[model samples]
Target: MNATTDLLPEWAQRPVSDEFLQALTARFGSQCSTALAVREQHGRDEGSIAAPPPAAVVFAQSTLDVQDAVKLCEQFNVPVIAYGAGSSLEGHLLAVEGGITIDVSRMNQILSVNTEDLTVTVQPGITRKALNDAIKDTGFFFPIDPGADASVGGMTATRASGTNAVRYGTMRENVLALEVVTASGEIIRTGNRAKKSAAGYDLTRLLIGSEGTLGIFTEITLRLYPLPEAVSAAICSFPSIEAAVHTVIQTIQMGIPIARVELVDVNSVRMVNAYSKLTLREEPMLLMEFHGSPTGVKEQAEMMQEIAGEFGGNAFEWAERPEDRTRLFTARHNAYFAAVASVPGCRCITTDACVPISRLADALLQCVTEADASGIPYFLVGHVGDGNFHFGYLIDPANDTQRQQAEALNQQLVQRAIALGGTCTGEHGIGIHKQGFLLEEAGDGAVQMMRAIKQALDPKNILNPGKIFQLQ
Candidate 1:
């Protein structure tokens, strides 16, 4: 067993019975697949977590289809895991306990576009990029991009945030409403198209970052932003990571309203340069974006340049054209893949640590020192404007020592972030990988409350069981 699954109980790994399989087949003929290929596709995600694939895969194309399939799982007392674009970075998609995975990629569609209200309701399977493309001509766009073409369901499930989160917000802030399937196969809608409501409990907020443990998202309503009138992207190189990070801290403290600000360490800069075939300076760099009216964007850029200059940042480069901005941001998004390719046949154990803006330098630099001293090859990148960063430690799957070393480094990072008044995971939800840390960060009392809520909502323990926390 892998590190992620070793601690799970054997009872949770219940085998899928022929009775259940036959019932599932009878419910949906061709959509129900027991093929190894289909099971494998729905079994894993982008993380290093490993587990046996589910016994069967259900392709749910509509809300009724999801409701019916879930009802069958409920009847059989079997665990049900939701599947989307499969871009999750933590172990959110792994089937630690043997179960059936409901793939929602086929359900991708835009249900409604209300330009007047600046809101869009969509099926759970639509990706952020696809959503933007569908509404590009409407003069509005969704800004909660998590660096991947992650499905809206997965993003909402994890409460994901990305480079633009500094200005707009994460899924927690932008998600307005949801249509969810409860463990009992009941469809429930929470919140509405209207912005703010003080009517009793905020179930919408409760389910946003629950990581599919409480319910499965069938439809989501998101707040949209009008396209920025004027936008500009820039990159500035710094002598060291400290300089680059400090610039971000200052920019945020001064209220610059920078749209997106990302930090790429020297290792990542070199890797992305090689992978993207660009001749960028191999130094710690800050990639930034500004949005507003023409004058406001210009003013923000000028203020940022002055702050960067104070920290000895140099070689300010601008990418003003739309194509140029895409090229720069695309390279930033591919940094993870570039790091993986740096070492042949290597997988990554990534760390997501977010601290208060004032403590970011200490949290980041200390972690960097430990990583460098441990001799682990890794790439460093962050949406530093929001004080969240990731270190992708490349590890050979066959080397036990390397894997342990990476885990130790990750543990150290998490402990440090918690000590500094931060979270173990900034955006990546508590999947199988970080359950232990979730207890450490939130304490037993709070975690028990969460467990209580989970138990109340999913009495059968069939909704993505064995995630977030292990039921006692």
Candidate 2:
């Protein structure tokens, strides 16, 4: 083994003995995996970096099973990495110090939906799409959409958000409560079903974005929104990206309650159109959605059009038909994959930075100009309504020069974001990818407090070690 691998803790390095595997198999039956390949596959997430495989993979089917596994790991001094759908962009699910990967996909079930209370309880492994589909006939919707069909557990862990975050807020806002298994094998519910409370310590918020460093989520209670009376979608083209961004800024300043406001650059538009088999104009465009009463939506759209005109934006192409709107959004939702597919054999180094609304256009222009000069293939997309955007740098990983350039660009972006009174990461948690940036953003005193909290909750550091904050 390499020196880096050799330096891992004893429990992380020691192989899963045949005797232990036999015992696990006897206890969990068909839920345990002893194969090295299966264990390795379960260890890593969708992050660009590769990680060491877990010593074992346990397909947990219930809260009792998760509690049992946690207790066993605690007794054995083994680290536990909670595995959901493995769809996280950050290295949230990577088993850096190999131990056990508790696969929660089998626990996918919606426990209950309290439409009157505007809340739902579900097992952690349930995907957002599954929950939405289940509640579709109830006239309620869960709006914490992060584009990907990620598990509720993973979404809660990462505190994820997407286009609609401008209106419905993020997981931090929607997750009403969580059922988590602590390092000591204790299951606790952090919050209640009430609308508001002056609860003690706010533990729910602490675990929502903990990224499995403090506890393994077993269940989640999330707030849901009633279906809108009327929804309108539109695609507005701009002569330049600055115009589109300016239009968004002005629209927000004018108090338009836009449900979603997304920006797709010319290159991104081209890729999505080709990948989705559509004939959209290859221009810098803004995809907007307004939700409210019919009169309200119409008024919002009209006001937004006037603001766009001021910024040299074209007339809004309204997707009034339900099918047309779905078609448009379907293409938008597949933008990341489309951009990735544009370059054969390319891995995407996606990163995002948020800035103050007034400084957004400048920040985006700077990053786009730098990317243009870097001679690297990239596409830009943003939740411009909230001054947050992501740049996908499609690079051949084997090319050292390209990888280095991409890293440099990412660093520059973070630096600019910090300089503009913004965060290095807006919605994505401070997983391994953004750990260094966290230090840069949150000062030494703030970081020390975070470390204190982590140490207090996970003294042994057996839960998701080497993530978020490194040891002193």
Candidate 3:
């Protein structure tokens, strides 16, 4: 009854054969599953996209397992979708072409740690938080925390960046290398342990944000940082969103190495206050963090407070103790969930846009004003210091008009960002939701090149079909 196969590439636009399916079950034994309950679980994730469940779910424990699954799917030309922690926001794991979902969650492992070199290799299923916890005793931490307990492979696939990105950069800069399995099930290493390389064709960067469309990442080598001796967090309230954004722009422009500078508008703050039980002013606020020696942190905090005072920002409230800092950021990290829970029976649609630091205020204000005018219950959260922000629009899925309106608003905002010389997606890669934006952002020629590469690597068009780009 499912006609999704009609959209797949001509090479793979056919239903999986019964013989190959039987062979697959016989080969993998307990690792392969076809129960309706498990298939439904692998059908969707944190995203709002609707996708039919895959034909089967393969719980792969190793690269060879992934290769075996891929090879089996290849024989029957069934598309393959890789699954990790299922924390993707852009529907990266959706099995649009009716294929097999390869669940890699059981492959969690921290392979090796090179403390002196400040790098660590981890299996794709290892979450960022788990990796950090594993290396906590090593006096170093993996700083790319994308809020969710997202697997390193999922994060790498999405090229995720988080609150720490303002100071530490995103996965794009942190990932040193990757071990990937091509569509044909051949395993290949993209980079080495060396910090820098003059290697031909930067393949690691290509696969970093491919969102499992190109190849599945088996292992990821990531850069790590020395844990700060003295870490401190501060919250500053502002008269308006503009003022708070201006302060972030000014702070970054002044070359201050603020570890994390997050902006939460009054709406989000109100929800967070109720959710986190924090008694703070219901005004636009910035949650900031600094990492350094004790004296350095003190100096940084003082300097930031001084700048905040210049832009109608209230006196900074500092959280110095480890316990206090944890509680503060935990609330900040829970903002998205807090927002969704604020209203009953409401699902959230998020929009991501990033502009030049100087243009952030304008872009953010435009989006805020439009969302405010739309009469939609929305909350604003951003990494303002880096000019990337997200609008969480709470909607009733039962109402089709609200969903349509939100989609239109997102399109307008993305166009505005492009007009202002910014990317359509700052962190969340272009899964099915942003494919149109990808065409507009990367232009025809670049998209063609991407298609060419996809065809060359996965000529059968079996790797996560209907993602990033729709092959003709």
Per-residue lDDT of model 2, residues 282-334, tens digit only = 88999999999999999999998888888888857999998998898878889
- The lDDT of each candidate is 0.92, 0.86, 0.87
TM-score (all chains, Cα) for each model:
0.98, 0.95, 0.96
Q: How are the candidates ranked when ordered by lDDT, highest leading?
A: 1, 3, 2
> Which ten contiguous residues of candidate 2 have the minimum total lDDT?
1-10
Local error of candidate 1 at residue 418 (angstroms): 0.6
List of clashing residue pairs for candidate 2:
none
lDDT of 3 at 298: 88
Q: Candidate 1 has what TM-score? A: 0.98
Tens-place lDDT per residue, model 1, 1-472, is 1355356554358777899999999989999999999899988888887788999999999999999999999998889999999988887877888889999998999999998999999999999999999999999999997898999999999999999999999999999999999999999999999989999899999999998998999999999999999999999999999999999999999999999999999999999999999888999999999999999999999999999999999999999999999999999999999999999999899988899999999999999999999998999999999999999999998888898889989999999999999999999888888988999999999999998999999998998888888889
Pitting candidate 1 against candidate 3, the one with the higher lDDT is: 1
Worst 10 residues of 1 by lDDT: 1-10
Residue 280 of model 2, lDDT score: 81
Clashes of each: 0, 0, 0
RMSD of every candidate to native, in Å, equals 1.4, 2.8, 2.9
The sequence of per-residue lDDT tens digits that candidate 3 reaches over residues 108-197 is 999999999999999999888888889999999999877888999999999899899999999999999999999988889998889899
